[model samples]
Target: MSGPVYFVSGIDTGIGKTFATGYLAKLWSEHGKKVITQKLIQTGNVDISEDIQQHREIMGMGWFPEDMTKLTMPEIFTYPASPHLATKIDAREIDFQKIADATLQLAEKYDVVLLEGAGGLMVPLTTELLTIDYIAQKKFPVILVSSGRLGSINHTLLSLEALKIRGLPLYALAYNLNDESQDAIISKDTSEYLKTYLAQNFPNAQWIDIPVVQHKDPLMD
Candidate 1:
């Protein structure tokens, strides 16, 4: 059977979606599962981002099957913008169907596939569809990666609401503490407040703490 879990979307761009995806993949790998990762619609790929390389290194030498990288990561774009904007600048279209197919193929082969979204949940993949819509269609349990920062509460709540409207299965909410000193109140109370609020509104969702670390280390603590 295919894997049962997939990371759906992050709260915003550069919110450690890759780091979290790598950490989750590493965790599964330690458990002796054939773990793989995919960066669907990777943008600003100059020579492969640090996040992709981190995943490969975490998999270790010779442990990664060739098909894992080849099948998983496709549609690398150079412009650091939304897929719609980036693809337009590059004179191409976002072939989301190809991404969906590739992810499914990897899931069919590997024990777990950590599919990372390009941007926020509502970021447009095409003219009509958003990233969260793709996740809902794929029917993957979502794990939202958020950060402890100013306006995080509103962003997280809006993202949660969008997912709810789409009727997606939100597995958990990971409030990553990337910015330790944003605003005193935000840095201190965002996680606790979100956890309590989500528990009340989305009872099925759990809150996980992902501490910010240097050198792209796993979320261990």
Candidate 2:
């Protein structure tokens, strides 16, 4: 049997989706589960995906064999932009079948696969296909990365509504502590409000807190 693949997406760009994914992979692996992470479509790089490198750094593990083989980063575009625009700029189209095949290959080996998306749910992988549309197509449970930053409530709710409209299962809401609002008041309230909202709405989903940590000096006191 294949392992479960959790689609990790954020409310907006730079919302710590990469960090949340790495944290979860490390956490689950520490608990004895074989975990691996894959980038759906990497942009802004060539020959390697910087996001995958960050994930490995955050997880404190060296590169995996899949990374060297390009299985973890199946599709890479050279431009630093959304997949649709990046693909256009690079004069290439995303090979969805290759990505699916890679994911299947990883699933066959790992106990869990954390597939990280390029951006928010609304981000277009192609002009006609949104990131969330791909998630729906794969029928993967989502792990939405959110933070207590300002406007999170609105953005998070909108994302939830889109998932609900498509009948997608939310596996967890990974709250990114590292990206919280600077104002303590707003940050605390945002967390409280979202927790209550999540409990009342998606009772089965887990609330995962991705803590802030200095990746560079992890061993420093």
Candidate 3:
């Protein structure tokens, strides 16, 4: 077809987008599909932390189609803030054209490409454009990842609303259990509640529960 599946933005940052993307990539590769993972925009790259390196190693071990190092990981800002702010501090600007060009290039090379966004859905990459807006224009079915926490219900609902506003196709919604303490109470209950809400509000959205794991490799499953 056109290319591999694309992962879309979420309601907020630190919601395990990278972890979820790596897991999906590894899972697809295990199924014998040639896959590639792209950060799209990575910040706070200080000597390649374990998180970033793990993705590279997982893709390599899985025998993915292309070299992990060659994948598109642009907008390497020093600050771990939003892309716009991070770039501003360094007197740099994010070139949406360059990011788009790289993404399309990877789409041409791989059977399944896992594209990861920097932050939340409304996080701005440029003055005029948000990540979600760009992904909507691409018209790829989104695999939105959310957390199981106090405000997950609201966050998930708002995220879905943003997608609807942008007219993006949502493939699924993955409720990731990133925090263990929250699992027994907040995590479990919130997920159930969100599942019900999504069924009634966004019937087309598939709800998936990603089990809590100790390491990044768990995501590969």
Candidate 4:
């Protein structure tokens, strides 16, 4: 399926979803595939989209200018919190149907559209809809990004279970090198455990350990 859309969701928040999406998108673009990225909703930034900007900077995405609000970032809330709470605090209502329409339009234009969700799969887009609900509705394959930390195993397993219950396709599992403060031994063990477990169970899913990239282009740094 050309121009496929993958919803890059995390087992939990702050799992490097933005970096992972940008890194993967850059690789696909380098291979001559026209890839575009979008952040479903953004909070914590008042002026510009720091997450989308980082994706563009890292991927050298110059197709859309900063003025293109709906393309790069469909929704924005000044409060740095969940989409539902943030939208409420900002006194704004989110029209999920409109958001879905915009996303489909972008997908029609590119070989791939990597969507970065605000937080976890269960993250509330509104009081009624969740991030996972949208992915399930769209039937988009999911790329779950988990932080390789002490409790990552339980978190990843739970996340996988949630996706399974929703009948969402688990396309890939990405382990981000978490903070060094986490016991490296536990992190190593967790990765090995998930590798074997996922392979034996979900044989079709790809298990990847993403390197910690410090900058946009590692060569430039």
Instruction: Please tell me which predicted candidate would have the highest lDDT against the true structure.
Output: 2
Residues forming the 10-long window of minimal summed lDDT in candidate 2: 212-221
Ranking by lDDT: 2, 4, 1, 3
lDDT of 3 at 117: 80
Those runs of model 4 whose alpha carbons end farther than 4 Å from true positions after fitting are 63-69, 178-182, 215-221
Each prediction's Cα lDDT score?
Answer: 0.73, 0.92, 0.70, 0.79
Please name the candidate that would achieve the greatest TM-score relative to the true structure.
Answer: 2
**TM-score of every prediction relative to native:** 0.86, 0.96, 0.84, 0.90
Can you write out model 4's per-residue Cα lDDT over 83-195, one digit (the tens) per residue? 99999998989867766777877888888888889889999988998888888888999999986676778878998998889888888997776332267787778788889
> Between which residue pairs do clashes occur in model 3?
23-219
Q: Between 1 and 4, whose lDDT is larger?
A: 4
Q: What does candidate 2's lDDT look like per residue over 66-154, in tens digits? A: 99999999999999999999999999899999999999999999999999998899999999999999999999999999999999999
How would you encode candidate 3's per-residue C-alpha lDDT over 88-112 as one tens digit per residue?
8768887767767767777887787
Q: Give residue 207's lDDT in candidate 2 (0 to 100).
A: 98
TM-score of decoy 1: 0.86
The alpha-carbon root-mean-square deviation between model 4 and the true structure, to one decimal in Å, is 3.2
Better of 1 and 3 by TM-score: 1
